[model samples]
Target chain A: MEWRWDFTIEILPRMLSAMLNTLLAAGIGYTIALVVGLIFLLGQRTKFRLCNWIVRECVEFIRSTPLIVQLFFVYFVAPQFGLVLSAWVSAMLTIGLHYGTYLSEVYRGGLEAIPRGQWEACRALNLSPARTYFRVLIPQALPASLPGMGNYLVGIFKDTPMLSTIGVVELMHTANALGAETYRYLEPYTMVGFMFLIISLPTAAWLRKFERYVGRSMGITK
Target chain B: MSTQNHPLELPEGSPLVRFSGVTKRYGDLTVLDNLDLDVGAHEMVSVIGPSGSGKTTVLRMLMTLEKIDEGVIYVDGKPLSHMERNGQLEFANEKYLRTQRTNIGMVFQQFNLFPHMTALENCIEAPINVLGMKRDEAEERALNLLDMVGMLEKKDQHPTRLSGGQQQRVAIARALAMRPKVMLLDEVTSALDPEVIGEVLNVIRALNSEHKLTMLMVTHQMGFAREISDRVCFFYEGKIAEQGTPDQIFNDPQNERTKQFLSAVLDAN
Candidate 1:
């Protein structure tokens, strides 16, 4: 199949417009993931053993299963149980929960990286547990968490293509429709790949700079 | 200062801090075995011992960082690890511990200054957050404490930027900012290099001579302990092998374990 300039130029506008849907899905999905990750992290940290175990196993089950399976289950299986969800809603929910488990582990690792001495210092200073966790521990954990958080940001963006399988009108879905209509896969698929590359590369770079900025601002670095 | 509000009646002339038959066990190994210790008001006591002799545990227990397996700790004449409920003692909850713990502050061997905060912020954080002091007032008191520790110039610098001795001085100042009635120094100088040890010890000496604060120190520096401590406790195998005025314990040393430990320690120097 020849790479045709005319065909590529013809489809550029549609692909670019579709990119907005992809960005929106990834952005909203990541926000949900961040909040859900905190909830999972709190569940794991709470004093209740049974709650911790249940949340932990749920996280593990979500993580171990395929993301596509989860997306299908939420979108296709829920309507049978009288809980109908739109493709966009199902995609966001599945993406949020699936990546949330990963992000919780990132948070757990970041928290564990803090030395035992810091907790003791908080205790000696008589800081309330809420103040200790929110003011002291979380800020310190952010620097350690930034890199893993950044990786997942890109991970979620790449994973948005999976939303196309559920008929979400995001970048990949639009590309697939264009290919089916035109009887040409080359232009749309290549454009989708280029669009993703263009966004992901700079995002990864920006995240690196952000991680350094957080570290320097927090005084973890000179 | 809230000591007056607690309803528990104190015995007349009772020490400010008392550890009555406190025992701490980690699995099968006993870190402190039926330990009885007391620190009178405005008194400075130094605990000296070999590694695993429970000297640091003495300070840790007083700070309520470790739960005692048996017996009770009293701070400001009220139970620290327990509460008076219906005229009987019950294990204190977090609320009770927080209120009672305000009277005591601890400085660790590792310094443990909040790395994200500057010297002044570290000192003021607990005061403003926990004690509900105004920011300006907390800053004023923290600056004074920084000045007292000779860390006034480094008030704006984070702990990573400061030397071990400087961080420790800041740690001491941070603890003192709370106006604690009793200060627990757990090998405060052990983490410093020999050259910087004097500077921290000098600040501690100033605290001993000039302030009326009660202090309990766990130290390996026999000479410095002898110079500043009103009483020196020699710990061995989770018990006080000997305790007396610094002169008596360091010079006349009656216990065989004390003599052996002292000789070994002095010979090293």
Candidate 2:
């Protein structure tokens, strides 16, 4: 089919509104990922053997299962269990849990990146364990982990389209509804693809800039 | 200056630094088995040995950086690590340990300087934080230490920017910033280039003569150890195979281990 100017012009405003909804969902999903990732990371580092094992198993299970299945499970199973959640809430939780597992590994890798001698030096100076982690370990670990964390940020952004499968009225969902009513698939789908490119490309670039800035500030790069 | 007030005294027969039947084990391997050692006040003792002879372990144990599987270590007539009158094993009161450790400072083989901090900041960090000294006082003392080590000009540079020898010198000054009576040096010059090693060795020799800091060093540099050390302890297979003046140990060579190590190192050089 040939491109139709009138059809594209007519649908432009509606598609823009859907784009806003998609951006909002992505922002919420990322915030949840940021917070839930820390919780999962702490669970992995906890002293309790059973809790650590259980948390690891849960993270691995969630990670191994497809995000689409997770979304469907949260959306369909929760109502049966008498704990109904809004489509938006279900999508956010699923996305958070999905990405949190990866971020925990990032945190662990960063914590281990610090040389053993740094810890021994702290012990030699008799710094308390609390002081050792906060003053020496975290400061060094956080910077080394920044690049990994930034990669996950981009990954989370790309995964936002999966929310559409669960009736979350995000970009793809709105595009589907518009196409069903108008009998026009190409315009909305193409517009959704363009909107995603607009958002993700700049975000990836900004994260790259941010990673360099963090490295320079931490003195890991000259 | 304050050395006169310190008096440099060991109470009667008590050792200023003592390792009483200390044993260190890593899994099934016994690194230091029932080893005992004593360092008198104002004495520079050098531990000489072949590889894996447990010379570094002795220094690490004295610095309280390594745990002894058996027996106790005493410093200045007090147990360096033990329970209080409550009669329970503890993680060791960190604050008390910090204070006690101020008397003993250690320089690592790799120099292990804080890479993020400047050379002056590295020297001043422990004094200000661990010793609770005023920032101005610590800065002043650090500058004096930088001058002593001949690194005052490069005080603002990061450790990575300096040569390995310069970094070791900065580390030595950082350790001495605490005015420690007993200093531990673990192969500090081994990582340095041959051309740069002399500058570090000369600095250490000057510090020993000028400040009379009681030094315990684990070194493979037989010539430097023989020249600077008053008493040399030859360690082999986790035990002190021979102990005597540098002249007796190097020239007379009482133990086969020392003789073998000397010949190997000398032939390599």
Q: Candidate 1 DockQ category?
A: medium
**Candidate 2 second chain TM:** 0.91
* Candidate 1 TM-score for chain A: 0.98
User: TM-score for all predictions?
Assistant: 0.97, 0.86
lDDT per residue as tens, model 1, B1-269: 12233335458789999888788899999998988888999999999989999999888888888888877889878899778887777778888999999999999999998888889999999999999999999999999999999999999999989999999999999999999999999999988999999999999999989996799999999899999999999999999999999999998999999999999999999
Error of 2 at B140 (Å): 3.8
Listed in order, the DockQ scores are 0.80, 0.40
Cα lDDT of model 2 by residue, B139-245, tens digit: 99999989988999999988868999999999899888878878999999989899999999999899789878789999988999999998999998899999999
Worst 10 residues of 2 chain B by lDDT: B1-10
lDDT of 1 at B26: 93
Q: DockQ for the candidate 2 complex?
A: 0.40
TM-score of structure candidate 1: 0.97
Query: CA lDDT of B127 in candidate 2?
Result: 80
